[model samples]
Target: MNIGFIGLGIMGSGMANNLLKSGFNMYVFNRTREKAKELEDNGAKFCSTPKELAEKSDLIFMMLTDVRACRAVSEDKDGFLESLSKGKVVVNFSTVHPNYSLELREMVKEKEAMFLESPVLGSKIPAQKGELVILSAGDKEAFEICTDAFEKISKKAMYLGDVPKASYVKVVNNEAFATSLTAYLEGLAFAKKIGLDPEMVFNILNSGALSNPYFEFKVKKVLNDDFETHFSFENMKKDLGYALSVADEFKCYCPTLAAVNEIFKKGLNKHAKEDMSAVYKIFDE
Candidate 1:
């Protein structure tokens, strides 16, 4: 299948590589023209705009940052909506508002195209290894047709039955991750301040119920002070903002998430100039 991919950031670039390696023909675009050139060098075709890329491909995968960027690629002049042909499919892998995904679904149908909300659960490393878990919602036929591509780019694909639900699932997952990571960082910092060896604390943590991939992977980065951006503070801030919006819409109280949201905000403030891992620094203070 010929696929068009937009947003060639770290995660998007890794996904595009996996698609090409999976033997699918790829047409690419990114706001930064140089990003497209980098993919072109890897044997992918480049398009000057979303419309141009959409016109030449059967499927379009968008891995942008937020709802605004998603809209920019979906509805702007010469965007995906203008160039999508009947029966074409557009899968959004960005984490954004479920309501926005629903709106995009309707827009795609108006164009006689299918829209799939496919927000993912893993970050850079999982994407690089094609181990990311895909949370998808759309027409069954569209899901079936894209199964092979999903398999090539992810370790698993979940069919969530509609647009907004997938977005909800993504936000819930992220809220949990952000909250747990914050708690872990705070406890670790407290232990260190009380004269416990940070390394020994982590060793005991691994031996207890606290051990998991997220902690194992991130604790190392925290200790090493490596705040390189795989995911950014900017993106997490957007996700937290959307999660709280969902809470308000549903009249739900999520005190833990609200607290973590503030910590994430503080982390972003302290390291507004650094990476998402800078979130750990808030506790260190």
Candidate 2:
């Protein structure tokens, strides 16, 4: 299959590499051309722009960071919408608002193109091993056609039946993850504040019922105070914002999500340029 990928950040880069390793013909584009150079060395062709990438590929996978960037690339002048032909599929792998995904679905269908919202669940390490889960929704025919490529980059591709539903599921998953991470942070922080040895507290958490792999992995970064931006604080803030919007739209009373959204904002305000793991600092208060 001719696969075109845009965005070359931590997760996107790993996913694209997996596609190349799986022997797909990969065409990659990044706003920053230097980012595409690494993939070029791996036999993935590089494109100067999204329009160029769209013209040459049957499927275009977008792993951009935000709704604004996704919209710009897919809807702008001479954009993917302009260049995409009938029967092509645009697979979105970014975490975006459901409403935006719905709009994009319509946008692509207008061009006789198919839109698949396939926001992934799992970060850098999982993506590297091709163990990331893809939650997707779109036209059934398009979904079937793209399943092979999806399987190449993911441990599983779950079809959620339609566009907005998959996006809703992704937002809820992020909300739950944020909620659990916050509670985990609070427990660990309180243990330290009460005169317990920090290392022992962490060791116990890592060894006990609360010892999830996420805690095992992220606690080290939290303890070492290394907030390098694998995923930025601003990104978490955006995710929380979108999740809360979904809750509000459905008249769902999600106090925990609401609280986490506030805490995410505070973390972003304090560490606007830091990694999302810095959300722990708010719990430290």
Candidate 3:
């Protein structure tokens, strides 16, 4: 497939590189043209605009930061929709509001193109390894046609029915992740306050039933205070906001998530560009 990928940030760059390595004919674009240089060196074609990329590609994938970027890329003067035609598929891997995904679906449909909400789970490391799990929804035919490309970029890709379902699930997953990480950081802070060694506490936790790969992987970063941006605090905060929106839409009471959301909001002042694990610094403060 001739694949067009937009937004070559930390995650998108890794995924796009893997596709290029897999020998796909890749056409790429990024707001900052410099980000696409490495991929271009690796034989991927660099397009100056989304419309140009869409015009030459069969499947266009967007791994943008948020809904606004997605909108601008699709509706701008030289947007993808300008050149999108029938039989083309546009897959969005950005974590966006499910409602917005539905709206984009309609817009793409109007262009006689297919839109898939296929937000992925995993950050820079997994994306680089092509091990991220994909949560996808839209037309099954579009999903099927992209299966080979998906395999090149993900460990697994699930088709979850229709537009917005996959987006909804991605927000819920991030909600659980943010809340759980916050709870873990709070407990570590409590341990330190009580004169217990936080590292020792983590060792105990890692030995127990509560242990999982995320905690194991993150504990080292937390202890060493390595707050690199594998996934940014701002993005996690955005996902939490999306989660709260979903909660409000369904009339669901998510008290813990609401509290966690506020904690992330507080971190926005200082740690927004850092890793999500930097939420620990809020407690450290």
Point to the candidate with the largest lDDT.
3
Report the lDDT tens digits of candidate 1 across residue range 1-285: 899999998789889989998889999999998877767987999888899999999999999988889888878998978888899998999988989988989988998988899999888888889999999998778888899999988999999897788999999988888788878888888998899988799989988999997788888888888888778887888898899999999999999989988877766656764556677677777
Best by the TM-score measure: 3
TM-scores for all candidates: the values are: 0.97, 0.95, 0.99
For residues 182-267, what per-residue lDDT tens digits would candidate 3 score against the true structure? 89988998899899999999999988986989877886799998988999999999999999999999999999999999999988
Show how many residue pairs clash in every candidate, following the order shown. 0, 0, 0
Better of 1 and 3 by TM-score: 3
- Rank by TM-score, highest first: 3, 1, 2
For candidate 3, give the lDDT of residue 23: 91
Task: Give the local distance difference test score of model 2.
Answer: 0.86
TM-score of 1: 0.97
Give the Cα RMSD of candidate 2: 1.5
Model 1 segments more than 4 A misplaced: none
